[model samples]
Target: MTALDVPGIRQVGADAFTWLSAHRDAFALGEDALTEDGHVDATWKPLGELAQTCASVCAVTTPADPLHAPAAALLDFAWLQTGRGELFPRLQRLEPFATYPLEVYSVFASAGLRHPGYEAAAATTARTRGWRSVEQDPTRRLGVLKAERRSGIRRPERAAPLLRRTWLGGLPEPWTFERSSGYALTHVVFHLTDWGRAPAGLPAGLAAYLTHWLPSWLDTCLDAGLWDLGCELVVVAASLPEPPDPALLRDVWPRIARAQLPSGALEQQAPQDGADTEPDFLRCYHSTLMAAFAAARTVTRLPGADGPGRPPAHDGRHRHRGPGEHSEHRERRERSGPSGPRGEGVPG
Candidate 1:
């Protein structure tokens, strides 16, 4: 993949972060953000996503890397927006049975911006039967479980059964893929791999399955100008146990780079005549964030990458055993080494 233009990929992340930093205030939660009438999608969700993306950038890149400082700054900005991690507890109190607050706060927690009050309250909430029994789509369940793990409240026994229920966990027929399923599959991978920090967290069989099919899905997204989903697929490829085909990535990266506007923003699709008056910032923010995430993830995985931090410990609860894959074989792989959508489009 030396021919994959690693610098170009790095540029994509740099440019996207620059854009996000310029428009940082646009992510501020509104007055009703924590109120019962608040629209989580429009308010807390975007800010949380901003925090999560910034956290990913900081986690994967060292301080010396150009992308690191701005990302760190943005993460700090996002934490402040939550009142230095104070708002989460307030939101949790208002919706004690709800999980979004915990989900959102987990990003900050993972980045070391903990809120003792919120964590205490969340731990209590998590132990309740209501919290444990809340039904969610399988893909979403994986995300909640991940959030629990990140927040130090995870119930280890729950993860394996949840994994088995996900569509990707089953390794369903490849032809069943579609837009909705596409999003589901990408998220399943994200949660299982802890957003690419632990590639071994994904079963070897699933890695092979994605490696074989991601190219075609990526091409389709590129052809349709689906920047949001395309960036996600790029992340999936980069997250695999082995990097994807150099040729596939080499071809795909430029198309995504070109999709980025001069402002560093990327839209789900090209704007059409008289597109609704939704602010351009709102329309473009999520895709831009995804692009940065995809770029940062891909670059850090390249040979001789310089991040000082190693991947975090893989959550053994996340590992799946595919047909005929034995416990010993899985353990051997473990010894080898670690590896949105608001607004802009679908809810990721």
Candidate 2:
């Protein structure tokens, strides 16, 4: 296994967050943000993503870490953008059945920001049949369940059944993995683990499966220049019960780091057909946010790293093993080698 390059990973995170902070205004919601016709994709999603990423960074890292303060500041800024949590209730009132308001607000709630009016309203809305029956993809349903948990709203559905419904939950054949499914798989892990703050939240079976295959998936993403998904995969690797092999991370992070523009933004997709055109903020925001998230999650897992509220270090108690698998089998696998050759036929 390659030696872990902690400094390199930190540098990638620092640059990405600095860029995000510098361009913070671009994440602001427009006048139409509260309107019926407002495009949630444009108006709310980016800001919500900012809050989520910032909150995750703050959750695992101490205020002393360079990444923590900016993330905290950004979280504050995002909360302020919601009119200090007032806008959420108004948005909820406007679209009572809409799930985005609760989903976005939950990130703030998890970060210690609260709005009584919004939570009260969401609680009532969640009890409605309309809200209860809202249809969503399995991955999205898991996200909503997680949001409800974070917001302290009561709901009857459990995550295990929902997990079984999603693509990753089934532990499907590795060859069947594709880009969209890859994102779905990563988000499932994020939701289950609370964005990497609690790796034990991941079931032993799932953790063992990922420990065996994540390297190949990560290599395929990096080889294809899928920076956004690649960063997400890195987060999944770090979130596993066992820390990822340092060699896998060391080999891929530099390629991801090189993809970042000097200004610190990372494009979701490199320009197609070899064009050199620069991507605007809309194209770069998510990948950059993810890069910061990936970095913050990873540093906490590295040996000798410290964070304010870092979870107890893995001590074998939480180490996941496949059914009937023993310590000797795991030891042999660890000693057997680095990851095998890259997976073939992986779609971008």
Candidate 3:
């Protein structure tokens, strides 16, 4: 099987943590300019590096396929656009970029790169930090703008309405209802459980939508406190050869939330809005993983599925022949094995 088909890749919990820790230096560009609130006041490095790091981590660890390219490109643009040229403004601007629920629009909003008015705030932040001049390459910035426009991905708008929708009862800003990082195998197990729990009667297109944006949204839920972080980690890490680790859950549970109503839940329950309700984290998680599962399978060579690079039968349990079918398959194998061409024959 290809790397894409190895369920372990989907469970990217520990691996993602390790990757991020290793690359912490790469992400440390404006650490000096960051405020207590998570903003970046400077632009010491190109934002592209952050995007590349996120994309590479996702691609190498997850079963992400064709969709990863565009996602990565979009993130790259967002990161660059948000980094103010000077150090101080960059710190104030970095909050949205560094925060959870990585929406496309928020990247711009966080960096004070969106609209004419935001420039004033960015400039003010920069000035406060005593960074008078910023020598940025306009072309590099333009490239990010161009890519974001081309991607056609919808970014979250930083309007009051969106904020109100996200606020879970005075919960902190940029709250993730859930958050997790680790191996891809954890993701697969979580995906299976999520799939099994899917409520009946979802439209056919739902799965497709979830796969493309699940990771970011899950980050949002974690940040928003809609779900417990330990639960997410547990769900993800469930796929290991051994049962899920109790110690892992115990360690993180204090930081994770208990089951609680999301801030948005009250709004849905309230009357007269007339807007289509946002789906809960459970639905979002399930939808994303299901789509990922389907996407991963698309790139894999499964048994009974014809392909140039089909997997050898002996490596995994999936290769086992069924009753009745085994007899004929064995007969064919025996006949073929005894007289097959030495070099051309399939391996025993």
Candidate 4:
């Protein structure tokens, strides 16, 4: 595939997964064939394919800086998954309930959340808990009902990024882009969608609120990046409905070009042995998404588009919210909590 340098998008290497297939024999030695409780056979199917894709992205994308530890966290997630064995299955088992934002990010990017198999897997969990639907807001709903037991649920995972950004204020840009603002927004949306499991569509009432409020979320991701260090988030956020500043793009492209390796391969160029830095996190996320996209392409054969897909279609007219709608809703969002309502899955 051609090298990609979009503001919010990154590319990985094509051969990074070879180690998985090559190492399968060691895993087979366990008791009772691959079906044993701890033994891993099924994990091989997607893990190997995913590795090659992740390795490619890690090999290609720009590294993260100090501020975007969360971004780097995403990259590292990918690196850890490159090998095949029980670890892959174990991680998969732990993915859903992972409270760590990085685990969430990794799971969101690489897991089969969108595939029917995932939906099926989660069905039992949802039925058992009787939490078929989650309503964070009255008007909007998210069907997180399909539950699966995931380990390592920690609230601190999300708190860390929020606190870091709250304290640090913004992150530095690692790579430049032609459409920085729009690109940054796209990454934020993608990150949220992949990691946060944002619902597919917003409710009508919440849609109105989001149209007005999302720009701020985009801004937060961008400005926060200046403090936290994940230019990818900022770049994706910057690349939203509004365009980015031309001068900013002109200044950043050279850094992106230089970030690439000599062979134009950009998967995990940084040593895996290094301490988990922001760059490492970015590589992890980049690799994971690259792997997911590659898997999506291989399985579905659809050319992938960047970002969280598109917002629901609008007629292009902005209407004022009816007075009956809670004006307090606006005020609460203005106070800086979650602005938009959770969405249900994308409609057929």
Best by lDDT: 2
**lDDT of every model, 2 decimals:** 0.76, 0.79, 0.29, 0.29
lDDT of 2 at 125: 86
lDDT of 2 by residue, 228-277 (tens): 88899999998998877766666667788888888788887777686545
lDDT per residue as tens, model 3, 274-303: 344544432333222222322222222222
Which predicted model would earn the best TM-score?
2
Q: Write one digit per residue (lDDT tens) for candidate 1, span 1-348.
A: 442454368788888988899999989988999789888888988999898887777777666677777877888788888888889888887999888998998988777777777888898888888987898888788888888878888574466777778777787775555666677888889888877887888988888878766676666666667788888888899889896666666777888887787778888665556243333877789889999988888877777676434323333111111102223323432332221111122755
- Range of the 10 consecutive residues with the lowest summed lDDT in candidate 2: 316-325
lDDT by residue for model 4 (149-241), tens: 221221112322332231111222212121233233333333333322232321233224334443344333323222122233333323233
Model 2 residue 278 distance off true place after TM-score fit, in angstroms = 3.6
Collision count for each candidate, in order: 1, 1, 48, 57
Q: Which portions of model 3 show Cα errors greater than 4 Å?
A: 1-64, 84-89, 92-231, 234-276, 279-348
TM-score against native, each model: 0.86, 0.87, 0.22, 0.31
Instruction: In angstroms, give how far residue 204 of model 1 lies from its true place.
Output: 1.0
lDDT of 4 at 327: 47
Q: Candidate 4 at 282: error in angstroms?
A: 11
Q: Clashing residue pairs, candidate 2?
A: 2-247
